[model samples]
Target chain A: MSAPRAEAVVIGASAGALEALSAILPALPARFPLPVMVVVHIPPDRRSLLAELFQAKCRVIVMEAEDKEPISPGTVYFAPADYHLLIEHDRTLSLSSDEPVLFSRPSIDVLFESAADAYGDALVAIVLTGANDDGAKGMRAVVEAGGRALVQTPESAFASAMPRAAIDLCPVARVMPLAAIAAYLLEV
Target chain B: MNGDPGSEKVEDIEIRLLLEAIYSQYHYDFRSYAMASIKRRLRQAREHLGFPTFSAMQESLLRDPALLPRLLGYLTVQVSEMFRDPSYFRALREKVVPHLRTYPSLKVWVAGCSTGEELYSLAILFREEGLEERTIFYATDINQDALHAAEAGIFGVDRIPLFTENHRKSGGKSSLSDYYQAAYGRVAFDKTLRRNVVFSDHSLVTDAVFGEMQLISCRNVMIYFDRALQDRALGLFRDSLARKGFLGLGAKESLRFSKHADAFADFVREERIYQRRFE
Candidate 1:
């Protein structure tokens, strides 16, 4: 049997991730059953245009998470700039001012690790284009937690280090180009 | 383990032992912290305390109860600024307070409030909103030292500029400086602003709701907890909020994926303001 119904899709990316995000968001249809959470490495002290930017391209309702606001399907939640976004077990969002991890606060590792803990086998963790190896251990944690893990192929990534690092560290379930990620998400 | 720049084997072992010893000796439960952050904090503690080994750090904490405060300074994340996301306060001023003022009296809880900055900021807001006269504010934290500091209502003068700017941006009515008196490079907040406020030790993870409240602002605290603990805290908040009560979280926090997602509806999504859903 197919694994448990996917509750959420989590993407952890850095560096040139926005390029891939543009391609990935529009791929998921409006009626996509699961919520999508994106963790993009952003500079501290800067505001993010991610929610506004992605909303225009994606069919889903895209909004920045307010504290205590519940997760809903057919919606997209982008990690706030500079804050570590996490999922509480009840699926609420929690943001941290804890010092940056791997020199990044909206760290892929933090999001991926937390999502894995919260959703476990129902999560789909994707690693995308980035310079650092931030998502490696977190992706491993996801796999160990019986969640699905996907990495963007290095050839399709602007900065391949992140996806390659994850590939080296764990046996990812899928490695696809940015164009194929959302398609794969739908098929799965 | 020697000269291996990347292998965390030895470092991890030391951190585990240190955390275990701290828990066994002092009953402080930091054993569940993420390894990387805990490792960094412990390193900072060791260096700050001039201990050559993690064992020395552990010995120092075990020997001197006084050292617990300093160790806590290292372990607890203390990065808070007044009126942190300015517009969140603005939304509170514009949308929430008008409703709050309708009630004859109010009870507000600021959970996971670190170092009193946020608590004081709220006190200022309530005073400006004219709700301070009938409000009872409870500011709770897990760190005793932070609770003590919060009760004292003192802060660095250097922070006043930014806090003042934030207050203004949040649509503050009067001069932000009026809320605190600056003396000799330190600021003591107005005592009257905090007259109805209480600072206490409360752990959202392990503790039950103490009382029902019209408003609860648990900002930036749940980020440290695992999902299970976060859910427990949410349950506490959900249980604690009176019917049609309000909840505020840090800018990045949300209730979307939570079991209680349907329990509250957004009043201002960007500002993270929410009202309890009608049962």
Candidate 2:
């Protein structure tokens, strides 16, 4: 498939997210053009340290996504531990305490589906290393909306279920290794 | 071909008309809510409620009075647990309770107290703090069903374990089992917990402030609203607070950049607890 143009990027990772995201997020240059929203499956009882952990590694701004905050062009927004993060068509962030999807509060499908609606063809959705099949349905939404879907090549992922699911759902998706995934995003 | 590639724009138009129909027919003002969540919910409603389109749903809604409550179940969120945020409750116990105890008689409003989880949490907290007898708790929501469920004060037995753990983490003084009786996979909290509580139908979006409150805990509710609607709710909280009263929000919600920012001073910043500024 031809490389699609991008306006924003949404990524979902679970189980092995820390190592998976570490390979890609920190590689983005300072003040990257598009907003990057991330969902890493986390236990609702504990505080999320992803934003703080990544802030030390990345040049881009990293913080938990807050409700009603307008999407800044260059910042990286991480879904907080318990709320499902979404992007409105108006380009502002929204948080939901509505029922969790598939027992995961910060569900990857929730973010990917909403971001697809907001960005449509201009969105790039990446499904990374995870132990579950959460992001597959969301990948279908992204692909159906004409947005780009990139899955980390399953074998290269620490746990392959998530990316494998996405690839199965959207056969048109581009499958790549961690290093190539980072390079692909940098080009966008 | 006329609409956006995916016809997403058409869906937005359909959704707006549905929300408008809901308001005109039922007097519920969800027109100004955050569209992303509203759209998500409506899609679920349309699929599960057996409507092919939002327009079709609106058509049924305009004609059927009975459909209003069922549709509302979709529009308003109703998921919560007692003492869901342990640190916020811990902050309340350690920091805000002393100030609250200063007031001779306290009025605590649990704004948007869905399904009574937060209300019961506060009721138990006040009782433990030695203030329940002197406090009048107003539990309000726009949804009548949620208000009634909250008044019933029964929760799933499975949820009690989490509630118990959270209570312990929030510096709970008494055994959680002392407050509720578990029977047939459901736990009904002690009826005395509601002795000083008033369950009422109130909307933060449309209802005016009814009483001055010493402490207001409106968590996770404002996240459903757009910025302007949130400003309206925050303004209501500001006006309803007594001087130096406290307002606590959901962990991720904040008063920063709100139109009512100056009306509140940060009392416990990390816990998203704010104090009504004395002006």
Q: lDDT of each prediction vs. the true structure?
A: 0.82, 0.92
* Candidate number of the best lDDT: 2
Which structure among the candidates has the greatest DockQ? 2
Model 2 misplacement above 4 A: A1-4, B1-8
lDDT of 1 by residue, B162-279 (tens): 8888888899999988877889999998888778988888877556786879999988776565555667778888889988999998777677646777888998897778888888
Q: Largest TM-score belongs to which candidate?
A: 2
Docking class of 1: incorrect
**TM-score of the second chain in each model?**
0.89, 0.97
lDDT of 1 at B236: 89
Give per-residue lDDT, candidate 2, residue A47: 93
Residue A150, model 2: Cα distance from true site in angstroms: 0.6
CAPRI quality level assigned to candidate 2 from its DockQ score = high
iRMSD computed for candidate 2: 0.9
lDDT of 2 by residue, B88-166 (tens): 9999999999998888999999999989999999999999999998999999999999999999999999998899999
